[model samples]
Target: MQDQFDLDVFGNYLFIFCGGSRNKYNALHWDGDGFILLYKRLKSGVIQVIQWPRSREDLRMVSQQELRWLLEGLSIEQPKAIKKAKTGYFH
Candidate 1:
């Protein structure tokens, strides 16, 4: 899968990543030739790899749309149910 999407930066090919809150099987759209859309449908497990303690955490399943943010060095920020304690509490 990586072999196909990973393209050179000489304009010869382009690789686009799109992540979203949808299922893993969501087909991503790429405006290119022979650019295959890769997706995986988990039968009985989680689609994204995360920790067990976070397993119960409300995770927004990423799709092709969200994958864009990931490739750009950004991260998916799902609205967490349990908010973390405020920083500078002692201040």
Candidate 2:
């Protein structure tokens, strides 16, 4: 992101990601005065990597709630839960 994206292009957006399970997340935002970089590491477990939409557009907008979920280590692209059969049989 640092190499591919520039302040001019990404200044209005926020970046969120972790290097992996052992690394902390890096969140970058642009304030009127300057850029604000936030780093957070959980005591245990890792932040969930967001599954971005498969789109042709270069930019996408994320809602505050979705952002909150992302920060909380949850998948913003949760798949719908599937129901099991009514039969009460087990192996």
Error of 1 at 84 (Å): 16
Clashing residue pairs in candidate 2 (N, C-alpha, C atoms within 3 angstroms): none
Looking at candidate 2, what is the lDDT of residue 21?
Answer: 65
Q: What are the clash counts of all predictions, listed in order?
A: 11, 0
Model 2, position 87, has a per-residue lDDT of 91
CA deviation > 4 Å runs, candidate 1: 1-24, 43-77, 81-91
For candidate 2, lDDT tens digit of each residue in 4-55? 5433534577866467463368888878788889988777766665444333
- Top TM-score model: 2
TM-score for each prediction?
Answer: 0.24, 0.61
Clashes of 2: 0
| lDDT (C-alpha, whole model) for all candidates | 0.41, 0.63
